[model samples]
Target: MRKEKLKVLLVEDDRIEVLKLQRSIAKDLDNYELTLATNGKEAFERIEEDMPNLILLDLNMPDTNGIEFMQIMKGRDELLHIPVIILTTSNNERDIHECYKLGIAGYVIKPLKYEDYEAKIKAIFRYWSLNEFLNY
Candidate 1:
């Protein structure tokens, strides 16, 4: 039997960050499909169309930040089950605490070094690949 590819939704506004994530996914991960959204509103729209297996969210965006997205997602039963991991540059304790309160699957601080960032992304993919999740 062939395994289905994991669908990932990446919500980020920065072009450079999106490029880095694409590179990381292309280089370090396999058996996955990625969908990109520039901000929370875009991501929400995409989710309405087709729910992804997981979401990689950035904390800062012009229209809707990560927290706001989470808040919106929390109210929807269909969307609430999807795992959302915050992949952001912010290292603020308050931000971390707030995300946890919002029930994030994980919080990752974006590393400055390219190699470190790649390694972290690789680990995330590997772990999620092995882990079990409910079929939607």
Candidate 2:
């Protein structure tokens, strides 16, 4: 039996970051379908149309930030269940604490090295693939 591809919605504002993530997903992960959103507002709209199995969120954006996005999702039944993993540069203690309070599955700090970043992304996908999720 063939396994279904995991749908992933990535919310990030930086074009370079988006491209890097896209490339990393293509190179490291198998059986994943990615959807991109530049900000929280766009992500919310995308989620409304079709919810993904997982969300990769960035903390800071020009429009709505990750915390705001999580808050919005928390109120909605359809979106509340989707696992969000924060992949961001910020390592602020307050941000980390707040994200956990907001119900993120995992918080990953983006690495400076390209190889390290790719490895981290691969690991996240691998772990999630093995784990059973009710919503997916």
Candidate 3:
């Protein structure tokens, strides 16, 4: 039996952050097929096309916010099963609570340093990689 490579949908608006994530994931985690979405609208389209194993989503977006996106996703049975990890800069209590309410798999605050950010991303992948619960 062959292990399947994880497909990651990265929904981030910042260009530099996206690049950094790509480089870090490529360097440390080789078994990921990554696709980017610059805004919530784009992310929605991407989700419709291909439901990735994991979604690294940013809360603040142009077309639509993460909260709204999550609401829409949860309503759809077909896309609701896919795990969504909130990777965002907002560390506010309301944001965290709201995200949890919306059933986000995990929430991560974006670090100022690139190395720390990379580590956090790696940790998320590592946890999911070994956990059988998310395999479904």
lDDT of each: 0.88, 0.86, 0.85
Of the two candidates 1 and 3, the one with more favorable TM-score, higher being better, is 1
Kindly report which residue pairs in candidate 1 clash with one another.
none
Residue runs of model 2 more than 4 Å from their true location after superposition:
28-30, 134-136
Candidate 3 residue lDDT tens string, 1-136: 1177677899998899899888777865567788899988898899878878889999988888898889888898888778899998899999999989989999999999998998998888777777675566
Total colliding residue pairs, candidate 1 = 0
Tens-digit lDDT track of model 1 for 44-123: 89998888888999999989999999998998988888999999999999999999999999999999999999899878
Quote the lDDT for 102 in model 2: 94
Give the distance in Å from residue 23's predicted Cα in candidate 1 to where it truly belongs. Answer: 0.6
Supply every candidate's count of residue pairs whose N, Cα or C atoms clash at under 3 angstroms. Answer: 0, 0, 0
Among all windows of 10 consecutive residues in model 1, the one with the lowest summed lDDT is 127-136
Better of 1 and 2 by TM-score: 1
The order of the candidates by lDDT, greatest first, is 1, 2, 3
List runs of model 3 lying over 4 Å from the truth. Answer: none
The TM-scores, one per candidate, come to 0.94, 0.92, 0.92
The candidate that achieves the highest TM-score relative to the unseen native structure: 1
